[model samples]
Target: MEIAAAIQRRGLLFVLSSPSGAGKSTIAQMLLSTDDGIAMSVSATTRPMRPGETDGVDYHFVTDAGFDRMVAGGEFLEWAHVFGHRYGTLKREVMKVIEGGRDVLLDIDWQGTQQLKQVDPDIVRVFILPPSTEELERRLRHRGTDSEEVIARRMDRAASEISHWAEYDYVLINNDAEKCRELVHNILKAERLKATRRVFLHDFVRGLIG
Candidate 1:
């Protein structure tokens, strides 16, 4: 009988978070679309689905009770309440993707990133910042998706979120979309070459010596 090694080799978790209007989601989408080997971990949320959002694709749109059941079942790697909606990443799905040797990209907040790091210390956390507070507010208002009060709330939250930028392993200032995308791609390239991830290095060295 053949035996498999006990080692559980997996791809890295790439986490990117940012304040609203900082363009993290756009960059994440771009990265995932461009990189065939990387998949985005769609979160489960206790929020009503917006137009054009498919179930289990954009998100696992669930009710509050369903989300609670998942939490009770130990299904989430990290869960958090954002703007009154609970959002969580399913542990099983993410693990399956990673174990399949495809990197998983998580678009979450700083709190969620912290929880993920606790679960897997190999997670690479990236935080995106707006060029300036004024620019951030301008972008928020320009979107015209929210009312005056809601926009004000988002701006206030942005300030607090930006304050925690130092907590991330990498920081990208989204002043130019293309430039920020390139920087994020560069970060991913550098991370994938780390010694720990290059498990065949020892074998390669042995071959050279022999």
Candidate 2:
């Protein structure tokens, strides 16, 4: 048998971060649906649970004080305050998934990605940017029913977020969403086959030689 066949691999944290109007979440959902080995990392939040949302499924809802305590105790791998609510990833839970040789997909912002990188430097970071600033604004306006002021604020935030594209490992210009999705699928497949991530490769090779 080939050594590659025998080597067991470790999973990676696949992160996708983008501006407010970019299709990060849509891409993430598409990835999850297509890839059975990867699972979405449910986040813990301090916000009130909305209708039809389940605990430990949609989000692990907690009190604001409890969230503060978790942050202070360093229980979260990454946490961020978004639109007046706190959201975080539980380090223990994510570690468990990674150890099981199944990838975890994270749809988060640049700040959260930075925090996650500090904890797990081996994570694969991918940033998706709209084809152009004008296109991003158009997408935002088309999707949101908010007032002009809110939309303008979102546009400003998108500009600020796009400035961090240089920080990511891979940057994809999302001119066409379907094409971008295929590109991301290819990236993940390549990352999964990386020799460095195959922790049992050495032993498997030795066995094959012996």
Q: After superposition, how far is residue 138 of candidate 2 from its true place, in Å?
A: 2.9
Can you list the residue pairs that collide in candidate 2? none
lDDT of 1 by residue, 1-210 (tens): 011111323478999999998999889989987787689988999988987789989999999999999999999999998877999999877977777778899999988988988988988999999998899888888877778988888887887888888999999889998889889988987887776876666666688899
lDDT of 1: 0.86
TM-score of 1: 0.91
TM-score of each: 0.91, 0.87
Scored against the true structure, residue 157 in model 2 reaches a CA lDDT of 83
Cα lDDT tens digits for candidate 2, 40-77: 88888988887678999878899998998999999998
What local distance difference test score does each model get? Answer: 0.86, 0.86
Candidate 1 residues lying further than 4 Å off, grouped into runs, are 1-10
